[model samples]
Target chain A: MSNNYNTDGDRMIDCFLNLGELMLRAGAEVNRVEDTIRRIGHAYEFERVEIFTINNMISLTVISNDGRVYTQTRRVSVAAVDLEKVARANELSRQICAHPVPLEEFKARIADIAENTRHYGKRMRYIASVVSATAFTVFFGGNWVEALISGAVSIILVTCMLFSDRLKIRPIIAILVSAFVMTMCVQGVTHFVEAATMDSIIMGNIMLLIPGLALTTSIRDVITGDTVAGLMGICDALLKAFAIAVGCVSAMLIFK
Target chain B: MTYLVQIIAAVFSAIGFSLLFNIHGRKLIITAVGGAITWGVYLIVFTQTENVFLACFVATMAIMAFAEIMARIAKTPVIILLVPMLVPMVPGGDLYRMMTNLVMDNSGQVRFYGHQLVMEVGAIAFGIIVISTAMQLILKMHAHITEQRRARH
Candidate 1:
């Protein structure tokens, strides 16, 4: 057996990768998401773990369930200080990943698949929200310039996502970046395509942003009797769609 | 030749999309075949009725039936299978058409194009509803049949 002491940085990166996988399985079920956060936090021996979805509109539930030791939940939004909170989460992940700890340090995490799922879901939701928002920005402007700017924004966002391990950018920013990318895509297609045929060009591209998968999955969740999760997932999809529409309309008004 | 190509493409695309979404095995194959058959039905109905909306509605029902049969045989998740199956039918091109019309300032065909857009969106929604309802019914039937089979034994 290799007697190697893993550092905090190593644990954080492992959690980061696991977070992506968890999100896909659990979607946004807070219980599962909270569990995932707890497992990840415990791996680094952090006392508290909080994951939130902050958007331009609507307050979100902060689902915090401690393993009977520390648990709390509250409503939160993206205020000026929220940026600091995100920065803190990023810093913790970065610090932990930089200092890989002993393998035994993650024993709790290995035994806590439920927690991993929740944390992953929370992470994915954060990514999805931001991506949707950015897409909205480009969607509304609907011009060659808007498209170019959006494309640039998408490039930056995707770069950040790829290097999220090194950069320690929180998942929430990734969500916003996705929104930006969608916006850029719609606008960019419209920009390059002839003005006489821009409507189809824009519409075709924007369809990719449609939460068809989410919508269908939500209904399935409802049918399978996971009503709470289903309702929340549907609500999240609706809110995201509304946000994209709002961004689009706002930009259109500005451009017009 | 074009219609044949469309059918093959729809099937292959449905299968590929399903795989991307993590569907596999017999159910996945059923979905792919179903999508191809639905596409064929869509072509025939549209040619006969000359109503794209109606053709789409009929095609949706046909595929939903296929999905139900596959779900019953497999006893696996229906939505997981059904969703990827419907990917090919999603009106990506129609959406693009509407957006292009709006952007290009083509005032002459605005009314015609706008109506088509609405109809296409509606058709997609209609397809989803039919498939979900069919799945629910299939589940109930499977339960009932299992009970009967158990009693007979």
Candidate 2:
């Protein structure tokens, strides 16, 4: 056990940092990220653990029993909602706390999680987007014909979004462009189909663009007392909302 | 009958959103059910009171409870379930209407929709804060009791 303790501090720090980075990039809020990291440190018998996380970055320090300190900073640039990864990471941390694993095995497990791909394929995502748009139409009291139009428009919008994502375009730009394309498509479709209200179709498809998740998470964070993270989340959500509104209104003006 | 159809649609929409968020396996079903419950409650309350804020508050509380229970059962974080389920209750429609009214130069309609949007969003935030704070307190109490019991032993 003493031998195990000798070489494990650096490796454990690396493992913890990797785990925190994965959770952060998977779109976890700041409080969860900080809590998970602190728990993992405590489980590993670290003397002290201090973690500070912002919207896109995490900085941490861990001190061992022998006066050794380890500090690391990781930048998490991507923010995609992959709940499976978040769930998997959360489970891993819990397991680490409950049953201590060796350094080699822990590193391997973290690697496996980091490399995990999404369960659904691109085609499935497109289909799901269409289904969601159609359902929103019905929920908003649109008829079957209007729902169908919204579904078609959703297909176009998702395609544009995917293409923009591939090009690594800024998120706000991508949202603005997609919203513009969505409204333009709706306008064209309205000219062709009689009695198809533009409001319902646009509203249905635009639901996909609104930053609902971000807004909710921000509020939850603020209420939980992480005011800075909450403010950042709120700003991000509002920026996206503004981009979408500008896109839609610009399209409306051009079409009118 | 129509309410049933709408409920089904809400479920489908939630499943689709779960797929988009890459939530898989049995958790998908739980999240979908959460969405259905939220929408069902919202629809009933909205129809009775015709007040979006009250409906949103009640629906948000219901879903937060659902998410908390599901998280404990599945041993997953509550956010994985909460975010997707909350999608249907989001004030997307009001935001769009607010923007549309602005474009048409309808100042009165714009103000009306804008006010509604703010109230609904505020209601959602308020509901989440209440439930989250309550749950945190309960968990703390449980922890304290366990600690005291251990000390007695």
Best by lDDT: 2
Per-residue lDDT of model 1, residues A1-256, tens digit only: 1122222333443444344233334233333334445555544444444443212211122222222232223332221111112222333334445553454543344335433212223343334333332333233334444434433444444444456535655444444444445445545555564542233223323443455455545655566455666677678765654444444444443334
Candidate 1, number of clashes = 43
Q: How well does model 1 score by local distance difference test? A: 0.48
True contacts kept of each: 0.05, 0.76
Least accurate 10 contiguous residues by lDDT in model 1 chain A: A78-87
Q: Model 1: runs farther than 4 Å from truth?
A: A1-209, A213-256, B25-28, B107-118, B131-153
Candidate that would win on DockQ: 2
Query: Candidate 1 DockQ category?
Result: incorrect
lDDT for A243 (candidate 2): 96
Q: What is the lDDT of residue B120 in candidate 2?
A: 85
